[model samples]
Target: MLPGHADFALPAPAAPVRLNGRRPIPEVPQMNGHSEAPSANEVPPANEAPQPTRSEKPAEPIDVWDQRVAGALAFLRRRLAGNYEVDDFGFDPELTDALFHPMLRVLYRDWFRTEVFGVEHVPVDGGALIVGNHSGTLALDALMLSTAIRDQTRAERHLRLLGADLVFRMPFVSELARKSGATVACNPDAERLMSQGELVGVFPEGFKGIGKPFADRYKLQRFGRGGFVSAALRTGTPIVPVAIVGAEEIYPILADIKPLARLLGVPYFPITPTFPWLGPLGLVPLPSKWLMRFCPPIPTAHLTEHADDPMVVYNLADQVRETIQATLLELLEKRPDPFGL
Candidate 1:
């Protein structure tokens, strides 16, 4: 007898039961010459199979951590074997999707609590220029914007950013920039990318927009030379004006150290509330509620011949700048508090 069954005992048969070739079935009690079913309180016969109790549990689920580890190993193996491909512009889509985007998503989705709108205006395929306001001292808005488009869009298109020459001047930074699909901000590069049906992003305000004093936040800076407009016109690509809020509050520049900036051969050296005083800890961006809006695309296909026209370029650039400014104000109204949940 089993240990748990010590208190239980099976009743012995009164008469010898015979089964020549078939299994023996439990005999039911007879009442008035008719067979009666067992009562609810009655115990089943020893020959019957036991039913499962309510305490029994289902099988355990697979470990997601194990799957992630296995996937990471496979990715590493592929990278080690040189099995990945990069485009002519040194853009590695696989690396960008697998590695870079996932890391940025934590900041984009959770830390900043970003909200995106007007993704429908982004074309599923073909060329388009995304023009956005620049801020957040460190250019983190650019990364967030790229991540946003990829996450929100149906096709998950990559935004080819046009970075300042200073970014490519550094060694490791240049390689990472190229792999992440960023080139120098130039008309030739922009035109080529758009011609290839790639979505190119440009910040016309340059360092001036991001390095502006905190008091001047959300104010539109002068778009340099309207070069982005000319590029769009030359490629006949529509320009999608985007406005980003909350980035202004992340690293508000209280002052600028021009001497330090010149010494480092960089743009304005910002002095934020925490930065340089808090040292390395100051690098962490504040948890601000972010709002991004992509306005309707301004078609430039009809202005292809006017790509070289200064007036046409200036007007288009001004139009895009105004659209972004208006959208920023609207988004600001929607998000009353910069740090509100």
Candidate 2:
């Protein structure tokens, strides 16, 4: 302390120490030595020999075609369970011959030939509500639409379609619908599916489209009070407007059976050229050329808080209707056949 400043007071030492040996001692475990004492980190060369490595086996060769086949088979097994076996609906020759055979041929051969636009509009993984015009006698349009999505996009997202009450009541029809992945037209079921990121097909027209008089073919009936629009608004999903052509010409209903409908507990009774009197043969839908156009997705991301507003719902519904109507007009004028390229 005197070397720096005589006035400065010096701090006391932490602890008293005493010298033990002439040389400073080492602070570590004892090490075996043959020749001389070694400094820290002075490991022997033998101890530093490189470790042996296991040889990795060659990676198995891949078969891309095998993967595709397996994928298609697994997909068929899951979706078309009863389809292969005899379903709850007795042996459906018509469905087997007419629908499935054609579908398989398309899937294996021509399905890829069709062109699709605005696929990006569809969410890669979410519940999307697709509101479309129902046509082609029965909901054959729905079946093809589902098939188209699956075949084209490689999306296994089954369209949990909102089917009519009549479908469930019928013994055969109900089972087929269940196997083909369709459910009733209700909000609970729809929301549950959409929440799971599934695609849902809704024909808001319902009986109106199927039962619309022959004179009014292709003229879209009034879409119910923004019900589907509300569904989208509630779920906050993009609405895809699907316009279907060629369904109109199939079994055109020239007349209605209001009396028969009331008695049979069904909507308008169809008076086609060959139904009821024609018996089972009448059920065969006329092979009208079909075209399904999935228009651009309408964004719901922008509405902010007004998504729940009734006026918003109404406007959205009108926009969808107008879009479909315009698309239908364009399709009718341009396309040569019902099932256009």
Top-TM-score candidate index: 1
Model 1 residue 119 CA deviation (Å) reads 0.6
**Total colliding residue pairs, candidate 1:** 0
The lDDT for every candidate, in the order shown, is 0.83, 0.63
**Candidate 1 ranges with C-alpha deviation above 4 Å:** 1-66
List ranges where model 2 is wrong by over 4 Å. Answer: 1-120, 337-341
**Per-residue lDDT of 62-143 in model 1, one digit per residue for the tens?**
4445677999999999999999999988999999999899999889877887876677788999999999999989899999
In the predicted model 2, the residue pairs found to clash are 126-197, 127-197, 136-247, 289-339
Task: List the lowest-lDDT window of 10 residues for candidate 2.
Answer: 13-22
Model 2 score (lDDT): 0.63
Give the TM-score comparing model 1 with the true structure, all chains together: 0.81
The digit string of per-residue lDDT tens for model 2 on 1-341 reads 45766452111211111111112122212453423344322422223433221111223224544676897777667546654443332334434444554664353224322323234445667778888887645776677667556544535444567788789889978877765667777766666666666788889888888788878988998888777777676677778887777778767887888998899888778888888768999886665555456677787756636656989988888888877887777556644665433
